[model samples]
Target: MAEASNGFFSAYVDSWDVLQIPRIGGFSGTVELPGSKSIANRALLLAALGTNPDRSCILKRLPDSDDVNVLRNILPALGVSVVAEEQGVRIQADHHRLSASSGEFYVENAGTAMRPLLAVLSALKGSYLIYGNEQMNRRPIGDLAKSLQSLGVEIEASEGGCPPVRVSSDGWKSQEATIQGRTSSQFVSAMLMAAPLSEKEFVLRLEDDPVSKPYIDLTITMMKDFGVQVLRKDYQEFIIPGNQRYLAPEQYEIEGDASAATYFLAAGALPGQGPVRVNGLGRSSIQGDQGFFRILESMGAMVKMGDKYLECSGGSELKALDLDMNAMPDAAMTLATLNLFADGKSSIRNVANLRVKESERIHGLKTELERTGASVEEGSDYLIIQPPSRMKSARFQTYLDHRMAMAFSLVSAGVSIEIEDPGCVRKTYPDYFLDFLKVAQK
Candidate 1:
């Protein structure tokens, strides 16, 4: 695998074979998921902002992915050094300058880079053109651009809020930014990460109810951990004073990704699979997506919860339960898989954010789930799924989103099926398919 600027395992899947795995054995074993790419990126930025002379913060469990590695490379560019600890990052990048060599900065297939860096470059004050890999560029940045513009930053888009985002410096010492609440929290995270560097102390507010409070909680936690003082009056209102210095201590650690844990939990729920116990993040953990386990209990999976371990086993005839995916939209696809096997019908609402960032998740999931014999319907903010009379053999499109590819792959555990872009799972969890295959015979 070729290394990306941030460094985890990153690969491009131009062509892949659609192969079938006959549903065979179930699994009961212990495995660990990679770090939350979201937290890694945020921590990298926070590490850069950390003021404590301590220099190192010990993180318990961290996942490795291309997005997080990009963050590692980023610190040194700004004169910070990131050393890899057993489970976290030790960071110290203090001197930052707008490198005048603004020709073309390329970040491949990284939404994390596209969002936060946009704010970083804007606050650093310079004329810069940010271009991404074809797929990354196609993802919408309009909501972010509009919000950035509202704060008096100049962000010119190619069209439809798609990227090749051109950001010019706003001379103000500091700026107050307002963003649409219904969109991805990445927009707000982007602005907050850069607020420490704004000439004046910054203030940020959301126009609507925030979509992902869990992610926002992560950002705030990382900010404070990295030695930056950030305040939120309510969930909607936040304040970060700029013109302060960014001090990086020697070390920090990233946590395991809870989103990735859903698949393993689901596999454990399969009848006669033994038991699946995944290590890393658990109760009292900072991640909100951890709540997916609760959603599973709602759908019939037996969950054994502990202070630091979540053990699940699949045995009951899954029931249909309506869900609100507004909190954790990234896992909506995983929820769709549970719905596919339900005895009745399940519906998901408040997930319109999928349309803007993912090319065609709703369509991709619906087509593939239906192709596998599940009755499903798609809409702007809702998805309806009716259990299939029988599972069938079908090849599904992944559209480069790892979740899409991995979520649908679950069908293979009980049927003969092929996935068009199985390799796409590497986008987040590089060893997802390979590791999953070891646990489930199907």
Candidate 2:
């Protein structure tokens, strides 16, 4: 890839094999986040499903990240028209045209793209093949495939029950199915989004509590916004009336990415000179990662909230925490690194799902944190971190994971460090280092 400048940053992120982050005084500025990748892709699919000749869905502030782009690029194959505008994207589709379409799609490593796309594609009267990069192919999709198969959708996953999924269906043939949710909530969310496409009432029952449950709520909330209602009995069952279709809203604005906000928030909470504020998410935000601010507060960081913003400043002393982060696994990566600055050992539990994410997060965290002199204990579903007496400058590998790259950047608050494959952040936040430089005082 050719190096391109963002006008602000001197070099292109993609051209860098290793990028050095200097120890900084601290961050003390506001960062305006991009649209939430989770919301943007979900909204994109919903908008495409809901579009008609009478109404076109105009989405505002949709993010221009690799993940969202994957879905955007593939929409045309499904007979949906996606046009880029100055503000966001406009989507339109005819139900008859969409139902009759069929094609191959490559989703890269975006779970948001692959999971939901699988369910939606299966609900249409078409034959489709959906595959992704090597990393995404390693992520399991069997639970979702089995659930769809039970619904009478002919589907087959790879040998290991991973992706490169093939689906052939003339539309829904059954009304009720059971899905195992313990592996991933995306499976559950996928089924929920597709249920409305059935001609009869669809009843979805969960076999176990889903990991990252908040994301399911996000899907339900967005589904309602698109004018589809889902009745739920706790987390175990969802009843989505069939013979219903998504009704596109005139326009929907995506909120700032709360996951991306965690890095700057941690910078403010570190032993710094002053406060750092992140604009885009507040108490009213739908993202579960917004709860990360509460985690910062529990760690003794001074936090203030508004309806659309969160502010944080260093406290007298950072306190360690022993907490379950099942609902906010993405933010948990940031918390894991933040533990390095705490007063004592910290333990983040109930995040074994991290092992199957874009990278094997638990093992990766343990390995990299140890390189920085932190004593880390890795578990099947948890991580225990003991801050070293003295931080060590080390070269950290990102494992092609965006969160890993951003989380380890926090180490610069105490010691100069080098991060490998810095461009991996383009998966979500393309301009991460440039934005980091804005608030970062070297």
- In candidate 2, list every pair of residues with a backbone clash: none
Question: Which residue runs does candidate 1 get wrong by more than 4 Å?
Answer: 1-14, 51-62, 74-76, 82-90, 94-103, 170-174, 241-249
Which ranges of candidate 2 are over 4 A from the true structure? 1-16
TM-scores vs. true structure, each candidate: 0.89, 0.96
Error of 1 at 238 (Å): 1.4
Candidate 1 lowest-lDDT run of ten: 1-10
Q: Mind giving the per-residue lDDT tens digits that candidate 2 earns over 278-336? A: 88888889999999998898888899999989999988889999999999999999999
True-structure Cα RMSD, model 2: 2.2
Give one digit per residue, the lDDT tens place, for model 1 in 262-287.
88887777655647887776786788
lDDT of all the models against the reference? 0.71, 0.89
Which has the greatest lDDT? Answer: 2
